[model samples]
Target: MTRRTVRIAMNGVTGRMGYRQHLVRSLLALREQGGLDLGDGTTLWPEPVLVGRREHALRAIAERHGIEQWSTDLAAVLADPSVEIYFDAQVTSAREEAVRQAIAAGKHIYCEKPTGTTTVGALELARLATAAGVKHGVVQDKLFLPGLLKLRRLVEGGFFGRILSVRGEFGYWVFEGDWQSAQRPSWNYRSEDGGGIAADMFPHWEYVMHELFGPVRTVQALTATHIPQRWDEQGKPYDATADDAAYGIFELEGGIVAQINSSWAVRVDRDELVEFQVDGTQGSAVAGLRKCRAQHRSATPKPVWNPDLPATERFRDQWQEVPDNGDFDNGFKAQWELFLRHVALDEPWRWDLLAGARGVQLAELGLKSSAQGRRLEVPELSL
Candidate 1:
């Protein structure tokens, strides 16, 4: 058995998602597990070169993680011949140019979604990656979540016979920075910085719906900036220009309708921050980040909707919990492993740059649909 190291230039590690999920949980976790076994007797180890704007932050992360390389120079990092892959978790506005540079440097690409702020930019990245013949992919981590995995299992096992509609509720209250410091960055509320609920989350809904049910044919949406004022990281008051909430109805290829309400302003009443209730002819399932519960048609309880008397039915207890048949890894790490295998061993992988473009397209169309106050058709995209 032979072991080889794959040098990955990871940008945007200073950000929350990038620092916590991608860098710490995913890549470092893989390293702790003695790297990934590549089936063909080759162990693939990841060596990440942290790239970001702030030298102090980068150095702190590198030193804390015992990572040898931390760089403020993206160009120099890209010029290094040893770097086999480039991963971006940067702000949406900054992603395209960096990715383009990575593609030009003959590096395989992997990054967070809303690959670009616009569909055109995202598609251009896809085309460039394709032309460069670099193995590329986008983070579709939600698909690998325990609940979604269970949902996929149920779907595959024909538990959800003749699947119908899907209802999703996602988001929680983000504190306005004046009184309480916001959990999310202040830039998330600024439209000029490529921030908005539609652009941020519609890409996720797109892949989730498309992969689980079918491709979206049309989209109808209404977006809102529920909170117009917030404070930045420096405690300075700023106008919140981005929409904090989005209500969307997506028409799928198989006549399935998916309605999703995404909002950062709304308080979370559901078990998870994000939950999806999928109904079908045979059964219905409600899935969150880590848990899934289902009720088959035969086991579903019938409740009277009469307001004359107090409701007595224990509706929540009716659904049976979906058992974890196997261990589930961190979704980001799981996808990273797959992408690594795809890059190293030519493994058959479906979530590529083109798929990412579709996600960006959905976001674009979603915002457009909201702006137009009408349903918009989603046309097929090509490279």
Candidate 2:
């Protein structure tokens, strides 16, 4: 049997997102079968090379993973004739330069979200990758999430006919490092690091909003920095500069109103990490990261305002324990597999830089709306 292997060079191999790519995604992607169900035992895999700063750190990481190759010099990695893909898990500030280097080195690129700290830089990287003729992709990881995928199915199936509105409640309190360490990385809480909930999360919403209802037409938003100060790992206080929370309302293609509240300050409400409730003229549905609870007109009671009586119940019992119908995998990991399959079978893969740029645009406009204290129209992007 002929075997194909992709030689990968991974940047930011030691940080959180990068660590996941290094230990989890790369480790799994490099394995045989890669969590795919094969009737018989067989293997499909890729070879990954560690790319990052600090030689001792890289070398130690490689030894721990039993990986043979390690490198501190990105230039050297790019110069290496064997590397086929350049993977960037670098910080937002460093992502653009890393992508440029990869494109110039003539390597296919797969990297994390936002693509760039600025919208223009993100678009430019896409252009460079296009001009360089190397395949490229951004980690639109949210779309691949199990819960959101389930939500997509419900939306596409028209479970709620003629969608009218969407309500999203997301976030949890991140520790201040005094009692417990912050759940999110320090960079995510800083403005200089290109960090902010609106910037980080609006990208996820851009596609979901587009996929579930339709493309967003306009936005009115309010952003906040709840925790003005935080302690890093060393317990030293630093001024928190990023918005920890955001409330946004968007106009979908069909005039549907979609509201999103993303925060890092609120405590979890239920077992659900995220909850989306959609109400239509015909029905309503509520979903979390996995299962969905829904009710239709047949099971609902129409009520009008009355004076002295207590209100009665309104909708059908939730669709409890409705099982998922497809293969279950972690969101980011699943995307990695899909990208690889696209590379192998030439299947249609359209999660391009355009989608990424749109995300950046949404975040930018969101901030704009907040700054101006008015609604901002979302302009269409060039395909």
Candidate 3:
């Protein structure tokens, strides 16, 4: 079989998600597996050139990963004729311009969600990519999770006769950095640094709701900064201007209502860090990050609400656990493989820059809803 190489200029490798998920788990793992089989007598090998702002950090990552090329010069990487793809996992605020540059350089572009800080910027990037005729994609990793996949299967199989509503609970307590070190970066709590629960999480919720149920028609949100102060990685006190928690109500097409709560200040009591409960006329299903359970109408136990009697129904045991009949790859890796195929073979890809722009639109509208203290309509994007 003929082997082909796709040179990728990967920016922002020093960040946590960029380093761990994209580079180490996905790209490196794929390389270790002897590259991707194109199914056309050729294999596409991923050759990543790590790009970052710090030379020491880039050198360290290269040394640890056994990478041959590491450079702090992003312009040089973009200018290199051998580079076919430019992937960005940078902060949300810095994505648009870098992606624009990559598209201008005639490279396929892929990046993380909330493509830009504003919906306009995100849409502009999409327009530019389309004008440049570059293959562009954004990370929508939640749709590929094991639990969500099972839920999708249930939906596709018509397990829910008439889908009614969805309730999503997501979050875990983040240390305030007073007595304990903060688990998240200090920038996450500062609005000036493109940090906020709504901005970071609303895009994920938007895509999930849109894909699982339908497009969002309207949204009502309330956001708050529960912890106002925190210490940084340098052990210095700083004010947290951005919100840490957000409670939102999204009205989807077909009259499906979804209530999602995202936060960094709440304690988790669910089966997983993130879970979604969907109730339908025929049955109900609850899906977490890795597991899904369903209770059909026929098997659901009848319960009478009475204050006079002690409850002994054992509600949690009634649901049947969904089995993983096939191997489930990491969400990031799965998307990465798909993007590679889309680029190499001109395969159909639905998760393009425009879809990513919709995510950004939802987040921006959510913030507006919270600020205005009312439900607001979500307009569809045209470009």
Candidate 4:
């Protein structure tokens, strides 16, 4: 079997999501598994060069992972002719320019979303990458998730006949630093730093809704900074200008309505940190991060609406747990592997820079909807 090493310049590995999800669980895990087999006996191995501003953190991460390359010089890394792919998990505000540079340097681009703070920036990057003739993709990890995959299977199998609505409940209480430190980074509460629930989560919702149901047609949203002040990493109080909570109702192409609540202030009462309950004409399903439960039309119990007395029926027991019929891999790694193949073998892959731009468009429209206090139509990008 022929094994070819694909050099990747990975920026922002020092950040939380970058370090844990992309670096450790995805890239390193792929390396430990002896790289990805290309089905035709050839294997594509990832050789990552860690790039970040913090020298100490980068060095520590590289050394811990037994990686030979770590550098603070992003310019030097991008200039390297040997680097085939440039992956960014940097802060949202810093992503556009870096990705532009990578595209100009003739490198395949893969990054986390929202691709940029604005739709124009994201679309421009897409155009630049396409004109440069370099492969590009964005991290749409939720679609690969076990629960969502199961939901997709159900949808494909005609379990949900004529899907009607999808309700997503996400987020948990992030403590203010007075007593317990905030679970999220301090910048997440600062709008100036490209932080907010809408910016962070609307991208996920965009792809999820698009991939599962159809493209989003219109959006009506409400956002609020419920906690105006919060303590930072240094135990100093700072004003949180960004919205911590966002309520959105999206209309999909197939007339499917998707309502999602994203918040850092709300306490979780559901089965998981995030759950999507989808109802259709024939059945209903609730999918969390790892598990999915379905109630088919035959099994759905009918109960009379009674206002006076307490209901004795166990409503939750009507649904059956969806079994893990096959081994489920890490969603991040799964997408990473596909991206790697897309770069190495020119494989057919759909989640490209255009898709990323669409995500950014949705986010921008959602924010606009909130500001204008009206439903806004999502227009398709001309480019």
Candidate 5:
């Protein structure tokens, strides 16, 4: 098979995710990891063209990567005959418009989540993309994580029989940049800029929640802004309008339930990474940020609820860290490769904008449930 050198056009190549996920992956594949393969030992990586709003930044990035082509006009890049795929990692508010324009340009689309702020926008994008007959995808990085992959293997192998419930804890304290000179981009704390814990993270949980267990049936949630102020990249203070923390409970298609607490304000005292605890009628498993544990029916524990118990005492003896297994996990980079392969050859890729729209659906439901003080059932999409 002749290796397809897929030419990629990238929008927002200077943004955080655009740089880390799209450009860095290109750098690694071309310079370090060696370009992608089609499993049959044929390379699939393409020449990448970086595009951004600023000409100087785009030129600098292209020079840094030893890439010659850079563009400030998205329309010109879209019209470029050499560009096969148009990838967007732009802000949440700009995703739909960029994707719409890309679709019209007859290029395949690969983009970030929340496809848009609303489910309707997301679904409409999907419809239009389908009408244009373009291959589209959204990044669901956790599905490819090694640790989570192991957890998935366990579930598929029936390690946790009669699966009962799942508990997910995710977050880390993002400093407010007041004392030690803050780091995170200020746009994240601004709702107008499409930054918030809910908009940023719901897509991840939507994929993980379904992959780890099953489809979400209903959700009850509340959002909070722990830190009301933050400094932007310029060190100027601004009022933080987006939610920094969110708590939600969702019921799966089966009778299974999941509780997820996501935050940008909470510091790690227990697990430093996102973790899941799955309990089944026959057995139970605890998946840590970087590790996992299992307790089978053979070793079912006997304990009583007590008021004077230490925080660490409950699951200590019952939980043992799952083996690192020496398997490397590329959280987002792996997903990038998968999308690349899908573009090169028509391989099956499950993470798409419709899936992302489902996440936006859940977030909207969460907000509705919070506003109405009730649990809201997630209506299935037309697909």
Candidate 6:
């Protein structure tokens, strides 16, 4: 097999998600596995050119990973003729401009979302990539998770006969930077920094609903800044201007209602930090990051509500666990492989910029719905 190398200019490796998921687990993991087999007579190897503002962090990552290239200048990296792909995992406020610059430099785009701070900006990025005729994709990694994959399998196999509703619980208590350091960055709680639960998580929910159930038709939301003040990375107090929690009700096609509550203030009670329970006439399933359990109509327990009696039914034990028939990969890595193939061989890809734009649109409308105190229609987007 012929070996081919594709240079990928990766930005924002200093961030937690970018460092852990994209750089280490995904790309470096692939490198360790001898790159990707293209199913042709060719093996595609990814050569990463780490791009970031911090020279110390970038250099440390490069040296630690045995990477040859690390740059503080994004322009010079983008201008390099050998760099075929541009990957972004930067903050929301900085992503649009950087991505625009990358697209203009004729590189294939693969980045994290919300693709832009606003729907309009996201759409513009999509249009620019389309017009430039570049292979572009967004990181919708949750769709590839083991639990969601099993859920999708059930959906495809008609396990859910006439699906009723979906209830999603996602979040964990992020510590304030006082006694204990905050888990997330301080920017996440600042509106000026493009931070909010609605903007950050609604995009994931949008694609999950759109792909598994149906397209979202309408949305109703209530947003709140539960914590008004939080300490920053330097242990200094700052006003939290963004909404840390969001409760959303989404109406999907085929009369499916999805209610998801996203919060950074709530403590986790579920099996996973994020989980979705889908109900239907035939069966019901609860899926988390790696586990899925289903209770069919035949096996579902019957419970009676009583004022004086203590609960005796083991509701959690009633559901059967979904077995993993095959080996599962890291979701971020899986999508990275697909995107690499799409760029290399023009593989059939669906998770493009437009799909990302739809996610951003949902977030935009969701925030609007909260502000207006009403349900807002999600119109179909184009171009």
Better of 1 and 5 by TM-score: 1
Candidate 2 vs candidate 3: the TM-score winner is 3
lDDT of 2 by residue, 212-276 (tens): 67899999999999999998888888999999999999998988999999999999876588888
Q: Rate the local accuracy (lDDT) of all candidates.
A: 0.95, 0.80, 0.93, 0.93, 0.81, 0.96
Model 5, span 116-143: residue lDDT tens: 8899999888888888988999878777
TM-score (C-alpha, index-matched) for candidate 3: 0.99
TM-score of 5: 0.93
Q: Candidate 3: count the clashes.
A: 0
lDDT, residue 132, candidate 5: 90
Q: Write the per-residue lDDT of candidate 3 for residues 236-342, one digit (tens) a residue.
A: 99999999999999999999999999999999899899999999999999999999999998998989999998998899999999888899999999999999999
Q: What TM-score would candidate 2 get against the native?
A: 0.91
Where does candidate 6 stray beyond 4 Å?
Answer: none
- The worst-scoring run of ten residues by lDDT in candidate 3 lies at 90-99
Instruction: Write the number of the candidate with greater TM-score, choosing between 5 and 6.
Output: 6
Model 5 residue runs over 4 Å out of place are 1-3, 39-41, 305-314, 324-326
lDDT of 5 at 250: 86
lDDT of 4: 0.93
Residue-wise C-alpha lDDT for candidate 4, range 202-239, written one tens digit per residue: 99999999988899999999999999999999999999
The deviation in Å at residue 171 for candidate 3 is: 0.4
**TM-scores for every predicted model:** 0.99, 0.91, 0.99, 0.99, 0.93, 0.99
Query: Least accurate stretch of 10 residues (summed lDDT) in model 4?
Result: 374-383
